[model samples]
Target: MFFRLNMKLFMFFLAWAFALLASSLASAATVEQIFKVQNRTIKRLCNERVIVTVNGLFPGPTINVHEGDTVIVHVFNEAPYNITIHWHGVFQLFSGWADGPEYVTQCPISSGNNYTYKFKVQNQEGTLWWHAHASVLRATVHGAFIIHPRSGQFPFPKPYKQIPIILGDWYNAGVEDMEKALAAGGRPELSSSFTINGLPGDIFSCSQKGQNSETFKMKVKQGKTYMLRMVNAVLELHLFVTLANHNFTVVAVDATYTDPYVTDVIVIAPGQTLDALFTANQPIGSYYMVASPYKSGGKMFDNITSRGIVVYDHQYAQYSSSHLVMPSLPSLNPMMPFLPPFNDTPTAHKFYSNITSLVGAPHWVPVPLEVDEHMFITVGLNLQRCDPATVTNDTCKGPMNHTLSPSMNNESFVLPKGRGYSMLEAFFENMSGVYTTDFPSKPPVMFDFTNPDIRFDLNLIFAPKSTKVKKLKFNSTVEIVFQNTAFIHTDNHAMHLHGFNFHVLAQGFGNFDPTSDEAKFNLVNPQIRNTIGVPVGGWAVIRFQANNPGVWFVHCHVEHHTHRGFNMAFEVENGPTLSTSLTPPPADLPKC
Candidate 1:
C-alpha cells in the first residue's frame, strides 16, 4: 500500500510539470506570416486594373496578434518595383531595423527579393496598421494590425464584437506614372475615388454594374456595444467620418488609451487611427456610414463620399418580406450624417484637444517634467527652381519656373544612398557622408508663420535640399513646437514619429505664442500618440523621452509631403547599459 501511494503521487507531479511546460511553450511561440507581393488584375469600380498586392489580397491580410507577441513577416517582393513595409504606430523599441522607412531604417527590399521583418510588440495594445513605405504602393498594399491586450482584458468594458474599417483611395492612373509626372513638375492629380476595405462602395457610379460590386456592411444586435477600429489610409486627404443616427465614444487614438470622449463625427488625418465604442441602441434600421474629404488648403480633392452600411440583425425579420427586402438607409446625396465644413478648423481643433490620456492605463507614460532639448520646427510647402533641361511649358506649374517642394525648415530632405547601409547602421559604423546631425533646432528664418500673403517672393519659398538629422543623448527629454507655415500653402499636416509616442502638450490655430501658450500646456494627462496633425496654419507642442537608442524618422505622414522631402531624422546615442542600447541588426535586413 505504501509503494502504490508513492507511485500515484509521483504520477500526479509529473502530469503537473508537463502541463506547465506546454503552457510556457504556447505563450512563447513566434507568430510568423509570409507575404508574396505580385502584380494581379483586380476589378474595382466596374473596371479591371492591374495592381500590386500581397498574397493576392486586395488590402493585404489583417495581422492579428496579442500584445507582447513577436511578429515575424517574410516579405517576398515579386513586384516590378522595390518595396518596404512599415508597421505604423509600433514602438519598435530597440529594434530600429524593423521600423521600415526606406533608407532611413533599412534599405528597400529590391524587386524579386525577400526580406524578413522581425519585431516584438511591447506595451502597446490597440488598433494600428502596416503599409508599403516605398513609392505609391500603399494604395492597395495595406492592412490592419490589431494588438489585443496581453492581460486578456481591455481597459474598458469588453465589447460584443470588434471590426476594422480601413479607409483608402483609388487612383485610375498608374501610381508610378503619377510619381514621374509630379517629378517632372506637373500639377498633382487627385485620387479618382475613395474606398472602404478596398471597395468603392455602392454610392459610386462605377460600383453599380459589376457582379462583384460590394460595400462594407456590419450587422449588429440591439443593446450590444461594438468596437470599431478605424484607420485612415488615404494618401493625401484628411477624412471626416460619421455614422448615421449614432454617436461614438472614442476610447483610444494611435493605439494609446484615452479617456472616453463622445462625439458625432470623428476627423482622422492620414496615418491616424481611432478606436471607438458605440452601443447599438438606435431604432432598428439600416444606416449609412460616410467618409468624406476635409479639404484644408482649398486644394482640389476627390469630392465623392465613401459609404458603408450598418444594419440591426432583427430589422430583416421586422420587415417580414419573403423577397429579402432591404431596409431603408439614409440617402448618400448631401450626406445624411452631417459632417463639419470642409475647412472647419475649429471642429478639428476641438476633437484633438479633448482627448486626454487615461492615467494608470497599461501603456500610459507621464509627460516629461524637464526637457533636455527643445526644437521649434516649421513644416510647410515651398518651391524650388525647376531644372531647365527637364522643364517644359506643360511641366512648370509654380511661379517663376519653379515647382512645389515641401520642407521642414529651409532644408528639404533628400534620402541618402548610403551604399546599402541604413542610417542606424551607418551611424554605428562611424561612416561619414550618410547623414549630417546639423538639423536646425529652429527655422533658419522666422516670419509670421500664419500670414496668408507670404508667397510673393519666389526666392524665400525655395528650400534647399539636404539630408539632416538631430542627435540626442540617451534618456533625454525632448520638446518640439511643430509650427505649420503658410508660406506657399496653408494646410493641415499630420506628423508621425517612428520609435515613440509623445504627449500632445497643446495645439491651437494661428502662431504658437510662447508667452501665452506656455500656460495652456497640459502637463498632466496629455493625450499620447505617435502621430498628431498640426492644425492648418497652426501649431502643436509635443514632448517625449529619448530612451530608445537608434535612428528614428520624424516626418509628415502625408505621402505627398513625405515624397516631396518634408522630413528629418533623430539619432539617439546608446545608454550606459547594454539592455537599454539597440540590439544588433538581424542577418536578413534588406540591402539597397
Candidate 2:
C-alpha cells in the first residue's frame, strides 16, 4: 500500500511538470498600453485649435509587438464624444468582441467611460494601424500598430532605420462642426490643408517661424537604407507620395509581404499602409518628400501639398548656408519627382496590380481552389427618397428631389439602433429585428454597370435602406466580384474589410466578364490585402475563407461614403466545436 501511494504521487508530479513545459512553449508574448482620449490645444498652420487626441499625442502613440503577441489596450475616453479604437488589419481570431467597429463588433465607449481591447495577433506581421472607429474623431485619433516576425528573419535584409510616415488631413474648423455641416446637406467641405505627421510642413504658406511652425524632418545617415512604414490616414483623399531624387523598393503592403518592386511614386488610398525601403545614396542634402491628393471623378479635393524633409546629417551641415540664403527650398522649386496627373488612373492601377504576394513567406495563404459562395456586389453613390418626418430642412433634400446616399447592391446599410447590444451580442442572444441575413448575393437590378452615356434617372438610382448582412457558413470560401457602378461619380472606391485579409485575384476597368476575367485570376500568387481599391468605373474579384466566426464589416474606406451608407457586413456562423468558435464577450465591453 505504501509503495502504491508513492507511485501515484510520483506520476502526478511528472504530469504536472510536463504541463508546465507545454504551457511555456505555447505562451505568447504580450504588449499592454493605456490610452487616454482627451481634448488638447495644438497649433498647426499658425492656428491654435483644440483637437481630440489620444494620450495628448496628435498622431497618437505607436504600439509595437511581435507577430504572436497578445495586445491589450485600455482606452479611457475623456473626450466630449463617443469613441472606439480599431486595430485595422489584425485578425481578432476568436476574440471578435474586441474587434472595434462602432456598432458592428461593439458599441462606442461614451464620454468618461473606459473599455479594454484585448486580442491576439495570429499570423500577421507588418505595419497595420489603429484609429477612432466613431464619428470624425479619427482625424486626430490615429496611430501606427507595428508587428515584427516571431522568430525567423524578415524576407528582406534589416534596415538601418525605420520610421512611420502618416499622411492626414487638417480642417481649420472643428471636425464636429464639419460633420454637422455635412449633415445639413451643405456642399462637402474640403480640408483646409494636408498634413505629414501632424505638420503642414515648410512648403505651405501658413507655416511660420514660431512655436506654431511645424515640419516633419527625418535625419538619415549616408549610404544606409531606411524602411518607411507609410499610412494614409486622410479622411477622404487618395494620396500620392514622392521623395525628390529618391525611389522606393516596395516590400510589403497592408501588413502582408509582397515581392519587392521598385517605384518612384507611391499611391495610397485612405486606410492603406505601405512599407518601402530607400537608401540615402543621393548627394547629401535636404530633400523634400511631398504628399498630395490624387483626385478622380472631376471632384474637388484639397490640392494643397504637404511636405516633409529628409536631411542627410553630413550634407545638411555643408548645404545649410546655401539653404539659408534661398528662402524657397530647392527641392520644391521644380518638384524633382514630378507627380502624376491627378486623374492618372492608369498609374494607380499599374502600381496596385504589380504587387504579388511573396512566395513561400510565413503567413502566406494560397488562394482557395474551391469556392463555396459567389457574390456580386455593386458599390457606388446614389440618391434615395428621404422620409419627410426625418427631414428637418431643405438641406435634407438632394438633387432631383432625392437625398444623397451610397449603397452596396442597391441596399443603403443602416446601423441597428439600441443600447448595450452590438451586432454580435444580438446574434448571440438570438435577438430578432436587429439585422437580417437576407442581404442579396447580387445586385437586385442589373443594368449597364459602367455605361458612361446612360442617362441619370432618379427612379433607377434610388436604393432601399436596411440593416442587412450576408451570412456565411463556417470555413466556407467566398468569392466576391466588387463592381463599381458609374452613377453620380466615377471614382476609385477603397473597400476595406475587417477581421480577415482577402486575396485580390484580379481587377480592371468596366464591367466584369466571367469568361475573360475568370481566366485572368491569379490563383497561384494573388496579392493578399485587408483593403483594396475598386478601380474607377471598374470591378475587382476577391476571395477569402470565412474561418473566423463573428460579424465583420465591409465598407468603402472613404469616410464620406461610409457615412452616407456605402457599407455592409458578413455574419459568419460559428463552427461546430469550441476551437473554431468565437469566444464570449469580455465583461468590460462598453455599452451604447
* Residue 220's lDDT in candidate 2: 85
Weakest ten-residue segment in model 2 by summed lDDT: 325-334
Write down the TM-score of every candidate: 0.91, 0.91
Residue 87: error of model 2 in Å? 0.6
Give the alpha-carbon lDDT of every model. Answer: 0.85, 0.86
Instruction: For candidate 2, give the lDDT.
Output: 0.86
Tens digits of per-residue lDDT for model 1 on 290-405? 88888788456678778888877764433344655454542334225776777877778788788999999987888889999999999888887778875666557755677767
For candidate 2, lDDT tens digit of each residue in 172-230?
Answer: 88977868756764346678788888887876667845565677888887678999999
